[model samples]
Target: MEAKQFQLAEELRKSIRGIVKTDEPMAKHTTFGIGGPADLYIEPADTDDLAQIIVWLNERQIPWFVLGDGANVLVADKGIRGAVIHMGKPFRKVKIDGEKVIVGSAAKLDKVVSATVDAGLAGLESTAGIPGTIGGAIVMNAGTYRGQIGDVTEKVCVVTTDGVQLEMTPENLQFRYRWSVFQEDKNKIIVEAYLGLKPGNKEELVRTMEYIRHRRNMNLPTVGRSAGCMFKNPDGYSAGQLIDEAGLKGTSIGDAVVADKHANFILNIGKASATEVKELAERVRGTIKGKFDIDLEYEVRIIGDW
Candidate 1:
């Protein structure tokens, strides 16, 4: 099986005209900087290139996972088998047409928000500090402050598992609380999104973005290797507050430590392994659960082997 997988990776390298890598460190690509290498990593050139790669992999029964900017994920220590597709430049395009914005899935949320704000668009201002791409934001229905990505999204273009293109409206997406229909159906890959926004004062929009940035800087640890928020804030309560109450702040397992400033953020002090981070997270969870009788749900997506 190992030999066959290697042969398949070689075939993929020859067939796809995009970047292909073997034994690529997942830590380098992730926000946490703490994961084992992936067996195969490919960054597709465009939607057509991506579709072709997917079709080839599917035909051969080769497993694959799509990754965005790695802002909201935790790859395992044992690494991953098969292919990992990281969408790149070709899908990072963003354009504004009057009150509507057409954003490629690979386009960063920060860039999208900034572009819309600069164009006097109002609806996305509250999402200014959010990281990752449009596709990830849409997949998770990413929200902050008082607004969510689903609120402004008009339609989404996705590629079905069978390599068929699908254009779905907001109603079809069925978004709610950091989840979407795409979360339940793993056979869809977001390609692009159409957002409906309204005109607002450009200066005001800029001010709003600045304010959000300031707030994030003060509340979250913007420095170091950490995947933003580790746990989702439970209903009517904050995860950080609960973790802090459990006395888990500054807790450490190897180089991984709960942020002294923010209990919900697990920071990599230096050269932390995926194992260390996972252990620290579990310890924090156990402590919180023991004290509060509430299981803290992880906001960061954990993937890869083990």
Candidate 2:
């Protein structure tokens, strides 16, 4: 069955101008640099090309997953079974129109922050130094000390599994702690976003972003392969502090370890497997739960078959 799927994927690859691969390693694309191969990986040339591919795949009843910069995802050891569409250069276009910024889903969060600040816009300054694209940020409601992506997002364009486009508003998005309506809906894929930001002094914005960068560098493990914060901060409590208090810091399972710099972050100590990371995360969660009676929920997206 796997061989037959690969053959079909090859045939489909020839139909599109975008790059496509069969049995593409998930590790190569993810921030953690781990996981097994994906059955089919496709990079659409542009929005139109993506739409066409989505339609074709929908018609054939083929399953597909949309990939951003892979900053906060954990692909399984057995790997993904169907198509994985990775939006590249074509989807990374960023445009600033007055106080409103129009950005593609594949546009990096850092790029958006820089562009907005350069344009004298203020809302996105706090998002500086965050990895991954705008789409992933919006879906996860990515935020820090300043504010969340939800605060700036005025509108979002998503492509549904049925090949239908949806223009969703903030109220309709159901944004919450480390989640959004997009995260709840498996079939929806964020394609672009319209951000409404307030005007601000350019120098002040630059200084703010610089301060954020300094704080992030001091607190997080930026050198290693990591998927940012491993667990969401439970209400009124930081996940890192809890893990540290439980004495789980610097804990290791194979090559995956709880980062010494930040106990909430699980770093891939080179050649780490997704299974190892998951196991370590579970152990941390168990320890924290046992010690504090507080369950630590995963902030990173864990996908694919076990």
Candidate 3:
């Protein structure tokens, strides 16, 4: 399998007219700063290049994962055996048309919020401080108390399950709490999206964004190697509150620890491994379940051979 993966990487490097790296360190890409390496790392030049590469890879049955800004994932220490397509800076593009913002899927959600707010757009102010790329945000229906990204989505352009490119309407995408059609079919790759926003007073929008930013700074891990939240809010309960009540805050496993400031976050204080992070999260889950009989589902996506 290793030999075949190497051969596939060679072929991919030769055929795809894009950036390619073998044994690329996943730690460098992920926010957690903990991972081994990806067998093959690719950055397609554009949508045309991306479509062709996906079609080719699918035909060969070579496993692959599409990564956005690498904020919401924990890559395993053993690394990934197949390919990883990184959709980042090179692909991000945003433009405003009247009250609509047409953005590339790789554009950062927070950046989009700021840009739209600068243009006096109102709908995205609620999403001001969310991290990760727009593509990942759409896949997870990322949101806060204000609103979800799926709410303002006018259209989504993606490479479908069968490797066909299509522009789909928002209604076609059944979005629920922290879930979307993309999650149901892992093969779907978001390329771009159109958002419908409303005109607003620039000062008011700025104030709202600032408040959101400050709230995030106060609650989230502002400076640390961590993937924001470890678990999802189960129905009517907040996972952080549950964990704090369970008395698991400041719990540690190896170098990973449940943040004392925000119980939902697991921080890598210094040189933590993916195994430590997962273990600490599981311990928190077990403690919560033991006390409240509620299962804690992970919000952080775990990838690679575990």
Candidate 4:
């Protein structure tokens, strides 16, 4: 398998202008800092590079996963069998055109928010301190009570499995509460997006972002390694409040602990394994279900092999 993987990497190098690594550690890429090595980790240089790589992989029937900033993600301890396509620095281009901003999918959500806010753009102010890349944010429709990314999104550019680039409008995106068309359509890779914004006072935008940041910092665990929020809010109730109410805070399974600061965040206080985190999450879920009769859905995206 190692030999085949090496051969695959060499073959991929021949066609695409990107970085390719064998047995790349997933731990280094994710925010949680808990994961095994991926068999092949790839970083495409640009849109054309990405398209070429995708087409090559598709032709070879290679299983691949699109990885963003790895914020709300968990990979298995045994790692992944196929390629992990990471849209890194090269894909983080941001171009502002009057009321619309054209940005690459890999642009950091916070950085984009800051940039747009600095430019006196009002729409992205609500997204303030959200982690992960723009691609991941759009796919999950990430937002707070202020607003959602989908609300400002004019269109999204995605590359299909066949390497065909398509410009998708709001109707095609199907954005709604922590969900998007990309969640269901694994074959589509987000490349670029256009966001519509209104002109506003830069001072007001800065104040709004600062307030949001302060609020988030006050509620979330700032010191520990975590994949942000663990569970999606169940309808009308907040997941964190439910877990806290259930007296599950500070709960631990090995080094994986339910954060005291925010019950929704399962933190890696020490050298926590994926299995430990999974068990801890399950325990939290069971307790919540038994107590409230509400089945909390996972906001974290668990990937790779078990």
Best candidate per TM-score, number? 4
Q: Write the per-residue lDDT of candidate 4 for residues 1-306, one digit (tens) a residue.
A: 899999999999988889999999999999999899999899999888999999999888889999998999988999888999999988899999998999999999999999999899999978888999999999999998789999999999999988889999999899999999899899999999999999999999899999999998887798779998899999999999999999999999999999999899999988999999999999999999999999999999998899
C-alpha lDDT of all candidate models, in order: 0.87, 0.88, 0.89, 0.93
Candidate 2 residues 167-265, lDDT tens each? 999999987777898777878888889999999999999999989989988888865699999999999999999999999888999999999999899
Relative to the true structure, candidate 1 reaches a TM of 0.96
lDDT of 3 by residue, 1-306 (tens): 668767888888788788878889999998899888898899988887788888888888878999997888999999898889988665699999999899999999999999999999899888888889999999889998689998999899998646689988877778778888887778778999999999999999999999999988887876568988889899999999999999988899989999989999999998999999998898898898899999999999999989
Total backbone collisions for each predicted model: 0, 0, 0, 0
Candidate 3 — which pairs collide? none
User: What is the TM-score of candidate 2?
Assistant: 0.96
Task: Please list the residue runs of candidate 2 whose C-alpha ends up more than 4 Å from where it truly belongs after superposition.
Answer: none
lDDT of 3: 0.89
At residue 300, what lDDT does model 3 achieve?
91
Q: What is the Å distance of residue 38 in model 2 from its true position? A: 0.5
* Top-lDDT structure, candidate number: 4
